[model samples]
Target chain A: MSYGPTPWVQRHWDLRAAANFAAGGAGSGLIVVAALSGARDAPAAVALLAGLALVAVGLFAVWLEIGRPLRALNVFFNPRTSWMSREAIAAVVLGVFVLRAAWLHATDSPGAVATGAAAALAALVFVGCQGMILRAAKGIPAWRSSATPWLIVATSLAEGAGLWWIAAAAHAQGTRTGLALFGALLCVRLFAWLAWRRSIARNARASAAMAPAGTALSVLGTALPLVLAGVAAISTSPAVVLGLAGTAGALAFGTGIAFKIALVVRGAFNQGFAIPHMPVRGKRA
Target chain B: MTRWAMVADLRRCVGCQTCTAACKHANATPPGVQWRRVLDIEIGNFPDVKRAFVPVGCQHCEDPPCMTVCPTKATKKRADGIVTIDYDLCIGCAYCAVACPYQARYKTERATFAYGKAAAHEAKRHDPDRLAVATKCTFCVDRIDAGLAAGQQPGVDPEATPACVNACIAQALTFGDLDDPSSNVSKLLEMNEHFRMHEELRTGPGFYYLWDRSEETGGVPALKRLVEEAMDLA
Candidate 1:
């Protein structure tokens, strides 16, 4: 009565939510690479600092999205029941490792691997929890598919790999290998997305919601990035390789944000009322 | 073990929307927000078309997805089967609204009036605390609780019944403890050809609709035979 005769969606989460996903993706992505890259010098500092900064920005973005930003801490009250609360906890743990990694980088510590690995694991949880957040929304069938987590994981990894490649390129470190991993992760995302779309297509409403977004994910989000990476892969010239790889990284990051925007904004539709039998003149609907 | 439920007899309902009006008056919901509504559904091709009135609202589901998804644990189901939202605890994230298949939940941050300005009656019934939070049909929890404290039985006493049920002019709506076989709702459900919406979801909704008395209402013999095992277990 309030919204629709058919199901309706709550238009609460908007661009701020998209920002949350993008910033969180970039942050977690940076930490993931920083943790695994085994970078003991200048590039490690760049990754650690940027990663922590983006995570903070992402947290703030979500905090701003809530009606009562001051009441944000109250979300911690239901960790046992809510993925959102768990995301907050994971964010805190990731922050701790992030700080330690930054300190290790600044202090020129040789045992940076432990701190980096801790940060990376925490980063994975932080990003994967966002997927869990979507999976927990049982109302939107499109978000609840089993493939959602894998897709998010793949997206996060690709975004992180892309950032590492960019940072490495900027620091004159070899960028080709990191670009390869980023490309591979994007491929993982493309496959997982296809699986997700197939699984959710069984539901009529979910299929309707996924149609446009799934197409965008397949064509603009997946194919465009991969094709660019292939061009970068084949190029023997230094400038050509760097520029193409940079463009590929940029596309991969944009795709991550676009996919989430489609999900958090467009793909959210409520399941409407249903009746087993349609009512007729002298009958019940 | 009080499980409150509602049973609507389609034959008796006139689709006058008195229940919808009564709920709005009782709840003082802001403009565009309704706690109860009667859906007029028409079916069949032109010449053979038929229409029916369906009272749709929160089912007070046994396994409410809204409750499961609330990040602040603001949405909860009572032991007595009334689903409610703790407004103070809710962050107005609208997660519960999206999770509810029934679309019974609503979130409104802005204050709106029916006819430009808030009328005296609306102003009287308005709940300021309800703003910026997920709100829905509580089955008139306040009335039930107050009546219980005053030694009145819910669904039995007029003062305790939901505003919608009490205002049904045709007596189409019955309210009672579903767990009590002697109760009006339970008795109505047992005697009539009744069904709950989205039963396949296994949410065990408290609202039941008595559609028709037709012998064919049960559908084919094969269908009956297929359900016989489950019915036998029940």
Candidate 2:
């Protein structure tokens, strides 16, 4: 019954692939959101290193998934057509920009903000490339929808905002802006997920599994964060506001990781064969 | 200028799976792997039902998504329209496997034999280079090339034709140059109504299925008219 007419879950990319997408997306989001919030000095350095480290872990996970570890360099061969190649190029660009921004922050220079801004642009490209990579997979109906890239970008941005809020709270910086950004992005992410779910045909088993899981994630990840952000916005006590924001941030970030894991592992199904017309038996020719 | 294509007559195929067995025997594919496959499809209610045996595999699409998504450029389409994979250059990332809508590509990480242990012949013929890499049906490219070098026509010569085509007991499968108007496949397509699987995807698959006789001219195919004319001339 292997690879029958019925759609089957793809086993080629497993938990390792899920890890790459989850961590890489969150890290890229963090870098962009941190830069946007005008984080500098000690906070900026932390975001730079943390984001790069997360991306490194993601890359390492994919390296482990590859069969030929030694020939990993060959992935750069086809940027003209392959989105994976473009993602690699974007990662390299982001790394270089982050390094430059980090150096500026270390020197107490005023231009670190500008450098961070440039790094943020590169980080956006890195995240966008990741979305495109998923969209490019024509075999998996769940990932092949045109709305997939938009959903991915929105979720990644929301994830980044969540991480940024947590970092701001940890550094004792004002987290009001981060909280507001996270709330706005959470709404956008929810809408994007809905749009994507509606657009794709839910014929495959993977699509069926993705629907309930995605809906639950939207409620838990988006609704909870929005509520926490709202309460924090109106709260008079500084400690209460910070506490709620931090908790909300943690929840949002954790949900993003879980959603990505579900997407890559639980929701990747191959399109099985289809016979459009059937031949009749004992028919007059 | 040559475009290799296959046309399977649905009415003629009996679902015997001889082509599938012949393909596995010719390619020495692993026990679980089938480069060529036959699907037994039954449709509709019991009183008004239909059954079909569909032979499916790599269509060698003109716009193959696998080739486009392969980051290492290991998957390539030859000039004669055969999609090939370079195992040495492949990084075994499985990107091509997911990108292939036909589900033709496969990646095996380790060596596996038909039995629990490798037979003497299996061990000798084991292809190490194919391990941990993307693999698919190549349309028997080696035989085609060898036959061409020996001045034999690919579709006309038994040695040049694909193993599946030669093994078809019902004469259901036809392989030939699509570009040549005189080719058997071209003539069959011209005579009978045919459809390609997933043609809406715009993959431009090289495989065709002659599902039913043309309704025009009282369901008498054009090829039969041509044959009748030839007989009268003789």
Candidate 3:
């Protein structure tokens, strides 16, 4: 019952917050990556639509996490001091740009590239704000470090590339670029995750729970995904390349979701209350 | 320049948990929720072991991480160094709950009683709407404000003081204006050897612990000081 000095958190943020953050990061990354790649055709469009839908669902999940869902609008009222508010504003900007891009493409208009670029920027901002939300919470020593935001953004980049690769895997015409991008993003994710784990391990107050997630992320998330994507990018065999790309996509997305759950859930152990003195066994004075 | 603070004398505490009960009764906290609690930890090896009682709730820190990360501006610190959560403004986002380094905040979705469903006492005590929001020790702000308005002195008047301070059976807890050197808490801090919880975090907690006079001042050697110093390095 006693937390000693390091209180084990009783799950302040349940599965809902984790799901929302994962979806928001992966979905936003998907939109940005899909746009930058030359897959502006049917598959990329599908991924964009799905990504936007996931983001919308993600926002709804946050609404469900609160006590009064009606008061959720107040979350966006304070952008000056609150990263959560800034995230809402960025979400709004992203929604508008993404919708505009979709409309232009639907109407066969010429301004989709411009709209896509804007949407990508907004999505990146939203994802960054989400990471800053965790970084801003100083109570969780594992999350308060400077590397948390970078790790989150890096994971999002890999997840987005994985998602885009999944959508465009059927057509080998534009798969190499997405696969190569996926490998690069995996490298970024690995570096950031390693740095994050090192920082957390060095913290005197941080629990040892996340050291395992770091290993997990490096293996299943970065190493396997990169190896599979690298092979797919250079492979001449269509069957082998497509199979490997699918595996890479699965591994990348799984890593993103798993690492986020571990970070937001178990990484949230309280730093514990500290004391300066102890009473002796036999003394009242 | 009114800064409210509490001074807990470790030598006087018997860990009776009277303050814990009094806080729950005064706040009408839910059946499982505790606004203030006394934790008993056994320190040192068995042969030289000693039991220490720590009365903990909120530090009500100078740099309250809860207030900084609050998305709705619902958590705020008043001019008197008391941190409070505005129930009306809080969207029940538990960010404040997690942001608290002391794990002081509590959130309960349902109003339950000790015996069964809502008893008559629970019905009278419970604020049904407070279920979703972040809640912690308010330092009995309502009583302090009402008592001040009525020209009663806080820390001296029972009605004006925090319920936990008033209910302490051992009189181990002292509360007063930290801004005034003449106040009970301030005088105690000046006259005794004291340390704050998590001082290295630079939170500048309003709560202080007066363990004992140091050995250099002709008192017993402070094993507690050695333990605290080693932890600070860790």
Candidate 4:
């Protein structure tokens, strides 16, 4: 009478999946922290350190899911043809830039422009790779569209801005950049909301399952932080009290991840052919 | 200045994954991860089935979103229009990961080391930082850099042909400078019915695919239908 496990869900949510969710959450948190702090001189440094640590952990989780880990390098040979290869190469380049920046900071050298540019490029490629990975999967209609990547990028930006505001309250010099980042986060959230609404409305099946949850997270989980950040920005409140904005921001981030994980798991399998039920007959024979 | 680009004659593509394999070998990437992926798409009902293989990678766009959102600025576009990433500088925020519409970037995980002891050793050795940042195609920047230094054309490295081009047994992948009118890629673009991925996004992708004249000829109709349906819903 009842169908078995749903194809949409992975067999057992393993370390890899957990790590992915955690990484996504942490990455978003760090970026938000950096944006809130406006530690321009050290924002990239902090972000790189946090980002890499999470990525390394996430990668390890992925290895746990697979049989062969060494063959991973084989993913990078096809920049001319493969998104996976390009992603590998980009990660290497981004790492180099991060190290260079760190070295410059340590040596008191003036390499911010070069390093910042490199990080920017790396960020774009990073998001692109995420979308490509989803697109590569033929079955997941939810992830195939261009909107997926854009949505990812928008969420990161929003989270980064939220984090920046929180950190800004801790430092005297970061107030301006923190507020600017808050504004940016608000804008990105708006864009992301629009994109999600559009996508959900467009796909009936996707809308039926994922859209309601996505809308809740985007509207409540994602929006609440920005609203708090905005309030903190405008109100002449004490820095200590305003710090609560960051806490709110972090909570919003968790909600965002919840929404993302739900969307991801729901769309894992293709809409397989509906099973036909057997007809019960008695007198016909 | 090396303005890197690629042109694919979709007409000639038979959906073979030579380019994928070539890329795998060239990059020495770990398993369960592909730098280059060939998408085999089928359209229409059983009686009127239509299949198309879409090979996609980093478009290396002129206004790359990844660059705009990077809190660390680890990725960059060169003066010659080739987008490159500085691996050492990347903190792996994956902010760039989300910014990109094409989904061209990836987060290299530590699990990559589990493929083999050798790969694990290599990961420990080469990427000691260990998944500390975002990554994607650099248009073979190392090869291009070396080629330029050697007074040869950029992206002309015999051993490093951007894995997909080399792996493409169908000989469907063509790499060259789009700026040069004489380049094979340029000529192919001019002669064939080519299209870039998500052309509407206006990312100005570095890669192009030539559609088969004899096939449905149009772009993936199913996608087109989806787009239309999305528009109506919106």
Query: Judged by lDDT, which candidate is best?
Result: 2
DockQ values of all predictions: 0.45, 0.71, 0.48, 0.02
RMSD of 3: 6.0
Off by over 4 Å in 2: A201-204, A280-285, B217-224, B231-234
Chain B TM-score per candidate, please.
0.89, 0.94, 0.90, 0.81
lDDT of 1 by residue, A16-80 (tens): 77677778977898788777667765567668878878988988887777766667887787788
Greater lDDT among 2 and 4 belongs to 2
Candidate 4 residue lDDT tens string, B121-230:
45544543435356676666676677677777643455434657766777778888888887777766665456776565556878877763312323356457668989
Give the 10-residue window scoring lowest on summed lDDT in candidate 4 chain B: B212-221
- lDDT of each residue in A1-285, candidate 4, tens digit only: 111111233222234654554454345345334423434456556665665555456556654543224445544434654454565676676566656755554455686556655655565566456556555433344555667666666665555444444444454334645555555665675576577657656556666677666666566655666666667667676663357566555655555555566656553333221111111112211
Clashing pairs in 2: none
Residue B188 error, candidate 1, Å: 1.2
- Global CA lDDT of candidate 1, please? 0.78
Tens digits of per-residue lDDT for model 3 on A61-145?
8788887678888887678888888998999998898888877766667887788788888989989998998898777878878
**Clash pairs, model 3 backbone:** A5-A272, A6-A272
- Model 1 lDDT tens row, B74-154: 888999998999988988777677667677877777677899788898777777778877899989999999999999988
TM-score of chain A of each: 0.90, 0.95, 0.92, 0.77
Kindly give the stretch of ten consecutive residues in candidate 4 chain A with the minimal lDDT sum: A276-285
Give the candidate number with the greatest TM-score: 2
**Model 2 per-residue lDDT tens digits across residues A104-216:** 88777878989898888998898888888889998888888899888888888888888877766675555566677778889898999888878775654766878766866
